[model samples]
Target: MHTLAQLRAGELSGITRLDLAEGLTEFPAQIFDLADTLEVLNLSGNALSSLPDDLHRLTRLRVLFCSDNDFTELPACLGQCQALTMIGFKANRISEVPGAALPPLLRWLILTDNRIENLPTELGERPYLQKLMLAGNRLQSLPPSLSHCHRLELIRIAANRLSELPQWLLTLPSLTWLAYAGNPLETEADAAALEGTAHIDWSALRLEQRLGEGASGVISRATWQRNGQPDTPVAVKLYKGEMTSDGSPLHEMNACITAGLHPNLIRVEGRIGDHPEGQQGLVMQLIDPSYRNLAALPSLASCSRDVYADDCRFSAEVALRIARGIASVAEHLHQQGITHGDLYGHNILLNDQGDCLLGDFGAASFHATTDNLETQALQRIEVRAFGILLGELLERIDSGLSDERRKVLEDLQRRCCQPQVLARPGFSEVVRELRSL
Candidate 1:
């Protein structure tokens, strides 16, 4: 985090990255001095409403972040930076995305928590585009040209005003992770069904050590006390209550409650009420200590896929066990009008015995079960995501396995990842095939 004084004094002239957050209402001209060497720039958490027209001076910049600012539009000068590939303007008041504001080499673009109502057709023209975050916006429809995004993978369009899901979005070849909850198109049945969860007052819980934290909230180990009942150990997630890149915390909590309980899913005890600070929270069954994340989050190089630890290896039997467990839970979720949009290995936990549990409702969405076509397409899209995970698991299988057995698993992965959208099998079919193996 560089200060204006250092920049003005030319002390940061040779740096490759610069971060400034002094609440300036205008661009600092001194930043141009590092244009020759700067590769990443962050000006987030400020009151800035515009950028310099000559932002192209940073010819070597590859990543730019201006989240939590006051910008009402994406700067057009960003298009001239030939090396810029990643741009983020999250939590801004942006209502417009000019066609000429985007660079051709863009790969990751985040405009979450904005007021944008439409996207440019040129967004699909970027051949290298992969990750796109557009949740919490006012979009009514998506451009048909987005179908041309062959390299696209992760996309979050939740909390928008879209009247219907785009058919072209369902057929995107490289799409793996997708979320569209909190839209008008969501079903009433699911909304009503998601309510009536048990509520626990915040004062009754005794907080313990911190468990973990994610983009939406922080989890902690706690002990719940009842008037006549014995104390119970549980895991509590207190949401930060802000619009995240994925969607709102309220929607995630609803999805988690609607999902109910299954052997393969983490159990939700109840929702937390009367938080001292008015924050939303949930009380869930604490996972056993033996369980650990199956893989790490994706790296810059891998872009959209999970990266497993190098020393990890799964036996053929263990891989099948993990596949069957996830397939079973996914089928259950779809049957309840829910889609676990972010079903990656990084979200799954497993024990040495190969028993797996799928958790995290941050990217889950609800769809109308009566709308068969749309529901089927939505499920198939998630099937592709699961297939990608399955393929990754298979890649870590022990090499000494029989060639015939390995061939069977490889063939199943190919079928799951088929580019012809509807041609791919559903989770139920996937489970059936895995059981036969």
Candidate 2:
């Protein structure tokens, strides 16, 4: 991050990226000095309400972020930056998104936690568009023109006012990750299983050191106090009170509660009862320290894909075990009408013996578990995500893996990721097929 003093003192010459969070109320005109080489600019956490009309002077700019600002409308001048491909205005008061305010080269757009009730059809015209985030909005419906986004892969429309799921969203050729909870259509029946869960009061717990933190909350080790027995060690997740990229923390808590338990899933003991600050949280089984993440989070260059270790390799038995465990848990989730929206390998953890756990319900959402075609389509959408996951594990297989078994896994992935969404098998079928191997 650069400072206002540095830019004014001519100390930031020829820089490609600049981040300014000085809480300014106006755009600095001196930024034009670096217009020749600046490629990325972040003016977030400011009181600024508008940008300079001549922002187009940054000819080399490709990315811009103005999150946590006071903008009520998207600056139309953004359309003039021909090289701009990514834009973020999250947590702003933006209600107006001008049809002509977007650049042709746009690929990723984030407008989360806004008051947007409608979207311009021009959004679908951007051929390079891939990732879109519109969660925590007031959208009533998605533009039908988005059906043209064949290359689009991930989207989050959670915490909206949508009355129904769009038919076109089901068939997006490349879509893998999707989150649409906290809408009007979500029914209580989807979470009926959550009713039987034990609620642990905050008074009956002894908080310990923090385990980790993520976009939605912090995980900490805690000891559950039993009145007539020994205390038990457990992990607790206290959700942050803010809107996340996926959606509200409340939504995630509900999904986790409803997810219940499976052999391969992190067992949720119960909901965190009364809290001093009225915060929402969950109590779950403590994971073993020996287990490690299957892969690292995605690098900026990899876009939506995760990054694996350089020497990562697994025997056929280990690979099959991991795949089967995930598939079984996926089948269990689907049976309960839940979809693991964020199913990347980074969310998976495994031990040396191949036992794996699928944690992180931050992006989970619920859909109809009935036999309707749309529900079936929803499951297939997740099938594509599983296909990508299977392909990743296959790529790192050890030489001892038999050629026939390798071909079997490859063929399963091919079928799961086929362009025709309906042709993909359900998670139950995926479990059966993987178990057969």
Tell me which residue pairs clash in candidate 2: none
In order, the Cα lDDT scores of the candidates are 0.89, 0.89
Candidate 1 accuracy as TM-score: 0.94
* Error in Å for residue 373 of model 1: 2.2
Q: Candidate 2, overall lDDT?
A: 0.89
lDDT (10s digit) by residue, model 1, range 265-286: 9998888989888889899999
Off by over 4 Å in 1: 189-193
**Deviation in Å, model 1, residue 414 alpha carbon:** 1.2
* Residue-pair clash count for candidate 2: 0
Task: Report the error of model 2 at residue 125, Å.
Answer: 0.1
